[model samples]
Target: MDEVEVVVAHSQRATLRVGEVFLKVDVDPAHADVEVRAMAMVPVPTPAVLWCEPPVLAIAAVPGTALGVLGAPSPASPAAWAAAGAAIRRLHDAPLPPWPGRKLDDVAEELDRECAWLLANDVLPAEVVRRNREIAEAVLRPWTPAFIHGDLQITHVFVDDEDRVTGIIDWSEAAPGDAMFDLAILTLGHEEHLDDLLVGYGDADRDVIRAWWSLRSLTASHWLIEHGFDPDEPGCEFDVLRARMPDS
Candidate 1:
C-alpha cells in the first residue's frame, strides 16, 4: 500500500495524496461542487475527478510536476512559462463561469482591513504597508471581467520535461475576474519570467499587473503566516511587498 502524503493542510482546506489519487478536503461543501463543475468547463488540461463525497473530492493527479513555487527559482524552462501563459489565455478566452467574481468594493474593503492589520500587528513597517497599499489601488478599479483562474499561482500549474503544460489544479476559486489578475498571480514572486509568459499571453497593462504584485503580497502575507508558511523568506511575499517601495 502506498503511504498517504499530505499535499497541503490549512484550516479551511487540506489535500492528501495516496499514490495517483489526491483527496481534497474543503471546509465549505459548496466549494467542492464549484471545483467539480469548473474543472468540467475549463478547456485546458486539469486533474480528472474520480469521485466526490460531500466535503472530500478525490481526483486523479496530473502527469507532470509543478511549473514552479512561489519565492523559488523555477527549474522549468522559459518555454514552460510561455506554455503556462498560453494556457491562461485559453482559459480567459473561454465563456464566463456561471458565477460572478469578487466585487471591487469588497476587495477594496478587504485591502483596507488587511493593511490595518499589518500595521497594528507590526507584520510590516507602516511606511512599507502604506506605499504598497497605494500601489495596489491601481488594480482595485472596475474592469471588464473574463474567465479567470481566481488563484492562478505558479504552484497550481504543472509541466512536462519539455516545458509543455500538462495540467492545472486547485479550481475552487475559479471564476470571472480581471484577465490581468490571473497573469499577475502566475508571475507573482517570479518577475524574471514575465517576458517569457507574456510572449504567449500577449500584451497587457504592465502597470496594473505590477500593482497586483503589491496587492497580492500585502493581502496574502498574514494568511500565509497563519497557515504555517513563512512569508518573510528572502524572495517571498514580504520581499515582494518591499520591492514596490520607492527606494527598495
Candidate 2:
C-alpha cells in the first residue's frame, strides 16, 4: 500500500496524497467549487477530477514534475518555462469566466490593510514595506481582465523531461484577473526566467508585472506568517520585496 503523504496542511485546508490520488480538504466548499469549474473551463491541462464530496475533492495527479519551487532555482530548461508561458497565454486568451474578479478598489483596500498590518507588527523593515507599497501602487489601475489562473505559482506548473509543459494544478484562486498578475506569480522567486516566459507569452507591461510582484509579496506575507509558512525564507516573498529596494 502506498503511504499517505501530507502535501500541505494549514488552518483553512489540507491536501493529502495517497498513491496516485490527491485529496484536498477545504474549510469552504466554494473554493473547491471554483476550482472544479475553473479546471473544467481552462484551456490548459489540469489534474483530472476523480470525485467531489463537498469539503473534500479527489483528483488524479498530473504527469511530470512541478516547474519549480519557491526559494530555489528551477532545474527546468528555458524551453520548459517558455512552454508554460505559452500555456498561460492560451488560458488568458480564453473567454472570461462567469464570475467577476476582485475590483480594483477592493484590491487597493486589501493592499492598504495588509501594509498597515505589516507596519504595526514590524513584520518587515519600515523602509522595505514603504518602498514596496510605493511600487505596488502601479498595479492599482484598471486592466482588461483575462481568464487567469489567479495563483499561478511556480509549484503549480508541471513539465515533462523534454521541457514541454504537461499540466498545471491548484485552481482554487482561478478567476478573471490581470494576466500580468499570473505571470508575476509564476516568476515570483525566479526572476531570471521572465524573459523566457515572455518569449511565448508575448509582450507585457514590465512595470505592471514588477508592481504585482511587490503587491503580491506584501499582501501575502501576513497570511503566510499566520498560516505557518515562512515567507522570509531565502528567495521567497521577503526576498522578492527586498529586491524592490533601490540598493537591492
Q: Which candidate number would show the highest TM-score if scored against the true structure?
A: 2
Per-candidate TM equals 0.98, 0.99
RMSD (Å) of each candidate, 1 decimal: 0.9, 0.7
lDDT score for candidate 1 against the true structure: 0.91
* lDDT tens readout by residue for model 2, 79-159: 999999899999999999998788999999999999999999999999999999999999999899999998899999999
Model 1 per-residue lDDT tens digits across residues 1-248:
99999989999999999999999999999888889999999989999999999889999989888978887898888999999988889999999998978999988988998898999999999999999999999998899988888899889999998888999999999888999888889889899999999988887899999999988898998899889999999788899988888887
Enumerate clash totals for all models, in the order shown. 0, 0
What's model 2's TM-score? 0.99
Which 10 consecutive residues of model 1 have the lowest summed lDDT? Answer: 239-248
